[model samples]
Target chain A: MGDLNTVVQSIINLPPAVILALGALLIPALPKRLRSPWFILLPVLALTFLWFLPVIQLSDYCIVAWNYADYSIMPYVSDNLSRLFSTAFLVVLITGGLFSWHNTDSGEKIATLFYASGAVGVVLAGDYLTLFIFWEVMAIASTWLIWGCGDVESGDVGMRYLLYHVLGGGLLLAGILVEVMNTGSIQLQSFAGLSGSDLLSNPGVLLILLGVAVNAAFPPFHTWLSDAYPKASITGAVFMSALTTKSAIYVLIRLFPGMDILVWIGLIMAIYGTIFALMSNDFRQILSYSILAQLGYMVTAIGVGSEMALNGATAHAFSHILYKSLLFMTGGALLYSVGTNRLSDLGATLKEATDQDPKFASQSRWLFGFYMIGALSISGLPLLNGFISKPMIIEAIGEAHYEIAMLILIAASIGTFLHTGLKIPYYTWFTRDSRSGSKPLKQSLNSKASFGEIPVNMNLGMGIGATLCLVFGIAPVIVYDLLPYNVIYEPFRAYPIAESLLTLSGAFFIFIWMKSRLLTPGVLRDLDTPLRATLPWIRQVFVDFPWAIFEKAEEIVLAFTRMVIKTVRNPLAWLQPYSSEEESTSTHSTEAFTPAIEIVIGLILFTSLVLGLFLIF
Target chain B: MINASNSERMNQSSFFTRLPLWIAILAAAVGLTLEFTLLRGYASHWWNHVPAFYLLYGALAAIALLGLSIWGSKVLNRQEAAGTNEKEA
Candidate 1:
């Protein structure tokens, strides 16, 4: 029928993000048994819509377009860049949904769906307002993923995480407003001119870049990622791992590609992450820091601003989402089964678990096997996903002739393998040495921690991620074809393979030599140390002081009202002096009116008389 | 050096333990050979022409990162547990 066709056409015109968001709202209403299935089905449906949609233009394919004032806002864009990023977000949603299948809390599940919708929306948005709205949605929804852990620390960590994001969202809004006022347009494509020093010279672009940098986990602004993700609920960490930073990278690729300042910022950020990851004792904390390191490579490629580099950044983001989520899933599985995330605690528990039942050790080995696949993939080992993408960025930098930047990135590659691939596994599963002298197993054994079997769903999620890593790595064309640019580079060639093997081998050898020294325990203070230390004082001065002043002013008004009531109700009481005892007990009471109150009343009466005379005249 | 796990100690001579070392050695040899022979023409960049450059570069870079990290860890190491010092006070 004609009416049915209209309905179908309308649904088809809806953005994929909006469909997922509407599905997210319906989650709690669904039966408990259907929640996980519904969660997985939505992204799959969105992915289908994403690919099957008709393309009007390959570069800026817009759908669901609407006008705001004089500006035409495209809420859904299906360019190659957006498509590549959206595909990753949607795929991770399915895998993350599967990982959290056993989670009883519908709030966290709903938050993740909404969070993915925000990320997808941001990537697909063709204008700044749409981008900013989804950017904040991602921030707010992701914060729930942290707080939904329902732990004592989760609340505090989530609050800090929210504050950081609110600040970022504010900066982004300010930039968008300034840019619209200056240029009279909100099109994101207009930022292509924002390259080199011109980016810094423009206040709007700089503010926008600063906002995106906060989400990208760029150095001093990056502590939130390390601070929050480890503290998020077990399954929530998996979703948080995939969405937040990569979406920022998507924004950067779309808006600020080729900004020269990013080159240095990204390089420092890469080393900063590696250094902190090396110092960390918590398993998930190390992974969080390594996310920063991995993001650095993509950021550096974006700074290069060539077709190959942008493609490399895009490809790396797609691959990073898969492998990193797998790593987090394994980390989450460890926390779920073992009731601890500390590396020192994990080694002892696994050791004790092995002593209790040998089979437990083998099962733990299977978890480790899944973990190593991700590790090797991230380390850019030959025949893995990292090899296919990371080399493109480094090769692009080499082509750009920024030899120093290239060398530092390669060194960072060595550090990545050292900390993540070698040190995390060695210290977590194999080491007998207790870097921290505390007997963590005592607490874990008595609590919910167990040597029992890991849930089947966890393995299924990890298996899906592992399969994708292999599929994409073996067939580089799959990822290459998804890229925004033509593929001219070869990852399988002799030079890159040799380079990856040599660097990874050298990293492996050094890790063997220095694994003991690297098995550090206890808190590794970062730049956030000073911030956390001063946050209380900062809050008191910035937040509490003004509030105190407002309260004092409110008290004065209440006192004056009481005096006026007494004057009107009993004229004799207004003339009578207060006793000293009454005055001391209640300073703001009607009985305690002083000369200042009388002078104010006299001035008011005089003003009323003058106003009355003027009106009569 | 990483101490062997109890299971690995029981089979100290297992090929898996030594297999990584062998692979590293062989990879270095093969990488060096490829740089000199079949991949010689692939050296479009100046750094690629340096003999066994990536192998040396990777080794030195690893050492430098480890050395710096050791010193950095010593400086930044906190005896207090995480989140304890920053409790909601």
Candidate 2:
């Protein structure tokens, strides 16, 4: 009985990656209708199992044996941080999966399962090697999701996406190799300082940092995200929004806490993402950009590296996954019903429905209401999820004495208000006058369009997420209890409440002012233009330039060959006797050539001269 | 019409774009100066500490330039729009 209990416990303690691998095999066998919902259930089951298992110490797992170096072995959950991140990841996977249930494609399910497994492995990894293995797995899986869009444009975007991630993975792998060589150990425990004295400061750390930055979608390397995300299938976009970057943030907090470079980089990303989001016209593109901005808050918080800051980072990550998924769900619903995600192609579907045509308006109202709640939550409006989570991050920044970081964060908050908070909902759901009535007319013209809402499964999935957003906003103690670190900072204090209200009111005033002035409808472009427009042109130039050179070279060779042939055919030439009918006939019959014999004679003379020089020397 | 040739078709200028090229040039100059002259002193204090300061300064300069560019582009856009309206009339 005792041994049986031990066996059961061991199976329960099997890392989420193993279960995810099993789920990947199980997914294809599932009926088409069951695939997505099964994915949602699989993560939930994993989380429940983790919750019930006994926690062990890091020493319990031997990641490297002298004989078994080549086989990748993962560490089970041993630390509070790993448990916290893993639990949150499981929740994200389930929620994201549920939200995407209406999307029936096999690729999204397979890719999402692999992506979730990678995130799980990262959180639970005992060593750098295991972490890197999952990291590359995530890169390949997410790229596949992007490629599953199945269009020429998406294929091109996916290639660019692959290029960036593969490069990142390479850098990370190199870093791991160097670290292993220096330390003779592969454990991923905390390390101090940046001088290459220890394994942490070696080339390995830099390479790993570069790799993490790519996944985080940090600048110059961020073009791949904005270029590909908006073009993803609606459900794929929602899942993509939640996982890859957050996993990078998780690893950053785990590996390099208090690295001051992260603080500055996070601040830049915050402001940069928000500014570009404000300029974008595509709805999903705006959301993609906002993901970068929100991640900045977490990355910056992690940079502070204090207990309060780390907690804030973790808490913000939890809330971000929920609200961001909600927003993407709203966008996905819009795409499904309207067949477009462009802001210019959107209108007030709710207002268009009259008493005789009430179903469409009701559905639109549900979607728009869901969208409003998500926007308000993400905007850090008082009493929503963002208000609760964002203030903790801001307090952490204040505690760290990073005044510039605070200012940048505030600017980013306001910019979030401008783009996601005000712009997205206003353009897609509220503004009836900006774009003509093309959308409504199209809907009315198609009799097959039933004016129905999204499938019950999808709506229920969204409802689950939306309810959690409201619950978390109203009472954040539920999340605080689950945090890896002991909570020292109180989020319900007067200062935080007052500050949040002030920001919300300030954003509201700005919106009113902009709306009154009719300044809100114009399109704003972002950093992706150079990538989307200029790079293709640049490639064309390079491609054509090389081709032009090749063509000229080919022409020269052809001209030379023709000249040789003309000279050989000339009756007055030195070879005229050899070119006589009988001699030519014999040569043609035997496949022999006078030109070949002459070339051999020239080669012999050249070699003899080279040999003579060698002998003399 | 999504005109490819119109200069106006270029993406909206942000802070990185609107900075006077000289400001960027000057910022780069300051960065290079710090890297060559002052970094050694800071590095001696603590190797990690010096890189931290450099990273912060670099970030601050980039943010300042970005903010300036965003504001400058908004101003330029307004002027261009006004000029185009006048020509139309």
Candidate 3:
């Protein structure tokens, strides 16, 4: 009885990431029937363990550590922040698992489990070393999802994705090493007190910031997201949409909250994501860009560094994960059902799907409803989750008296509505080619279409996410209670409602006015343009150039080897300087071993043999 | 109209064609009214003192963003290679 109690206690103390990771190892052995259920159950069990663990507290840290050599490695650290973020992650995992319930690919399933585990592990980690380990695990496992799509383009995109993450992981490791040496400790701590130029003095923190920035999709480094997400396996995109950047945001919230530079950086990201999203034509690509824009809000809140602001960032991240995953799931369903992501062609693609499966006719309407919930939630429409969380950051900025920053964030919100609320829904489900008198463009019909019925599980997954968005939106206290800091804030007030409605209305009107101008089907370039353009040159300098020089050197060495061999064969090939024409005409002349050459060779060999024999004697 | 399908012709005359514009106008009107009346007492920020500030600011900001994006499209949009676009996938 005591042993049983001890075992139960031990299991409760185990980190949620370890549970999922250990369960992931058993995936392949499970029968196909059991895999999906197991996947869903794992996160549920992890969440149960997370909540039931005795040490989890709101204000103080309760660490679960393993002593190794001279190090006290704390792998399970329970604070409100890690707990809240991990809860969000686990919830998304369950929903994502359900969404991909029909997927037969065990490789993708395993990768997803490991990927999710890594993300949860990062937040739970008490030390930098543990954080870096989980960070690389995330990088590698997520790359596997990209590759599992099994297309030439996805393969290429996955390689690029891996390269970026590996680079990020390297930078993080460098920072961690420097920090350990300088501080004589690997424990993670807040750099929030280091502001402005004081941050310049902490090279380790700066390196770590740069590393986390890469994963967070902070501009220039952000292209990997847009470039890869739209091309990921339909189900993979759903998980990818929720995990990577949000985990990085969690890290920022943990490590660098209140760093002043992040405010401007966040503002830039917000505008940058909005602009790029507006110009994009791919549905999933648009969502990916919006993730960047939304992440900007959280980053800004973290920069504000107030209790309400950090709480706001955490709440927004939690809500963003759900809604964004829902959007991606619906978008994935659209992509899965119609086999395309082009915004201008979505209506026609759905039209095409009706012929393949009659049920596909109504799927679009259902998907649109689900998609809008996500869209409106992200736009911070009143009564949705976005309204509950987004305004907190804006209000915090307002309270801090950075009036311009407040206004810019407000404008960014307007832009968010402009694209997500108006442009995406408008072009995807309702657009008509004016030239053709309300018909979808004829060219879109000419494209290949693989129309089918959306799986029931996909809808169920989306329904769960949509329901959570509403529940959280209507009851902000549920999210508020989980916040690390104690703060009183209200979301459903008259002023916020008016602000949201006015902004959305304004965006909606402009969208109608600029409808034609917004039909952007062309591929959009971003800061990644120079990188994409110079990729071949980079390959040439790094790969092809070195190989070419090596090849030339190899050829010269081979030619010298051949000359020595020829000399040994006849003893006259080098001694005789034949004209080029003579050498060309008489290919076999040297092979006949002339008597004079053979005699000289024999005499040299005899002399060498005699000298060797004398020396041995 | 000679080569058009029956559904295409119906789409041209459908209520859906005009519904969005009406909705946008209605929403704008309601938003302005709410900002001016019901929510006026809730104004704590300086910008809130301006008449229909959120409505006007939202509109102007959207227009500026649209202008900037249109310019951006010209500089940034590339012709995607055939069979390489996400639509085909």
Candidate 4:
């Protein structure tokens, strides 16, 4: 039994992230038929490795620790919190792969697998350094996903996305660097709620919050979500939606809970995203804004800072990933069947049609049923995952006596249904404004006529997602047990059910009452108005930046050349040309190079000062 | 002329249009009845657990958003033609 325990511990100690990452590297070389199965297999292997470890204290149970001379790093740590998120991430990886099975681009597959693995990497990281490494990996790999959506505009958008995240990464690294210098140890689990004085005293914590908040889409830093997500590939968006923001939320809940300002930031995001999403025309853009809104709930829960609220945040993250992926999968399927994502143009079912090859008739596509399940679940309808989890946070906030915050959150729930549940589906599948209503439309990704059915794998991905949503909802404890904290909150109670039903009814009423207004298909302006308005200037910064560098370098070289020419032509030019003395001091080499030395000295001092602070404080 | 497909989908999605009306009425009736039930909590603030509080709040929130959105689009939004010119620049 002792030997068996040792063996189990050794096997489980390997970080699932490393396994998935290595698996990603090997994917491009795999046989064509084997690649699809490999996608599902790798994440499953990682999950299995996470699950079967000997029960022990969190520090001892299946930990991978490395001691390098003076520095020690624990790269892999398994606890309930890590395992719960890892499980959700791996399942989404499998389903996302399934949905995009027909996309033959190996680069897309490899980048996506790496992106998913990076998310697991963050969850399993036991120290700040390990967390930073995974955080960067997720940022870079997800950028590739946006670019892989395949167009020149997507390329530029991916670059913009990369630059913003890089700024966030810089702040995070600065914080971690200062923290390690101050504390001289790398412990990063279970931070207690800090008082305002503690926060004021520490600059490191504030830097970390700013870094994480960018990814969480906290108000002013949020436009990146709306800008990039709508342009991502159908399957890629599914993966992107599940990981980046939620992982940031996980880090925040783990580290910075109970910050009073988080409540207001979250409420603003919830209402703000909801309103814009209601006004947006594209279904995917609507979903993108919905990400901001959904994240607001999780952020607010983290801010509320009770065991029940933390549990709600955890459970809600798990359920949101599943349903949001389902919603994206529905979009992917629709985009595959029809040629566009415009809600006004996208209505009509499959009709019988044979392609150029007489034997090839497209199969029957029934995505609406699965789509409705996702829509209703997101709206927090009764007997769905969002219902089971979202209410817990609201109840916690209300119980904690933030009655106004709770009211706003409930109102935002109405906005959630207004956009995601009603507007998107109502415009996409149920509208009668199609240009040629009776004829079968052609598919874009594949050159087949819209006829028989959606791809089986796509439907399977959505079905699995919808099933999990229903299961977590009906028997809510499955999610509750997996949360990092223990809390007793029941969802089947009357008050919550009453509120959820009423919110849905209210959203329904608003949608109808403003039906004509919302029926007009056009884009709403984002709060990040400057980003779009000055896009040309933003592009010119990048476009003009390299030439500016070259021009500066040219000036420096020309100055050096002129100095050399003068020295060769007239070595005594440093002497006064019209001085009373016929000759100046013969060798004043030191005085001649004073300005150059000053410039070099200034640069060196600035670099050392910045680096020295990290070393000292 | 409306196609068969359009009418069928309308029938299918009639729930979006009709269910709200029915559920709004039902929520009003049942929420009022719940005021007498043991499940209702103490009203710490003025608006706490008002009968059909969700309905009143959600409807008012929606209307407020609509009014604000109309004003924003008119005042804050640039023309689509302007967007094209910017992209070209």
Error of 1 at A433 (Å): 2.8
TM-score of the B chain in each candidate versus the native B chain: 0.70, 0.33, 0.72, 0.52
Residue A608 error, candidate 2, Å = 30
**Candidate 3 per-residue C-alpha lDDT over A1-617 given as tens digits, one digit per residue, 9 for 90 to 100:** 99997677677788899999999999999999999999999999999988876553323575477677677688888888999999999999999999999886788889999999999999999998889999999999999888887868888999999999998998888888888889888889888788867757888888898899999998889999998988888888888888899999999999988888888889989999998888887888889999999998999998889998899999999999999999999988887766567776765555445544555546666888899899989999877899888999999988888788888888889998888888888777665441212234434442444345678999999999999999999888998998999999989777777787777777777777787797656788878778878999999999999999999999999999998886587654544445345667775476433455556678899999999999999
In model 3, the Cα lDDT at residue A199 comes to 59
Q: What is the CA-based DockQ of model 1?
A: 0.34
| TM-score of each candidate structure, all chains considered together | 0.89, 0.74, 0.89, 0.82
lDDT of 2 by residue, A359-471 (tens): 55556667767887788888776667887778888878877788768767876876676677767776665555455333344542224544445677667767877887899
Candidate 3: pairs in clash: none
> Which is the winner by TM-score between candidate 2 and candidate 3?
3
Assess the local accuracy of residue A56 in candidate 4 as a C-alpha lDDT between 0 and 100: 42
DockQ for every model comes to 0.34, 0.02, 0.41, 0.21
**CA RMSD per model (angstroms):** 6.2, 13.7, 5.2, 12.0
**Cα lDDT for residue A136, model 2?**
84
Model 1 reaches what TM-score against the true structure? 0.89
lDDT computed for candidate 2: 0.68
Per-residue accuracy of model 1 over A362-468 as CA lDDT, tens digit each: 67877888899999999998888988999999999888888899999999989999888888887776674553555435554434434656778888999999999
> lDDT tens string, model 4, A1-617?
99998677666666789888989898889887778788888988888777864244336533777776665777887767778888999989888878877666778888888898889998888788889999999999999988886677788779878888998899888888777788886757455567445765788887788898888889888888888887787778999999999889888887877777787888999988887787776678888889899899999888888888888888889989989998888877766654456564554322112222222122222467677788888888878998988998898898788888988888788888888887776666555454322223332224444333457788788888888888887898888888888778889877777677766766677767776566434455676677767877866787788779999999999999998885577544434333223225534544434344555678899999999999999
- Number of the top DockQ candidate: 3
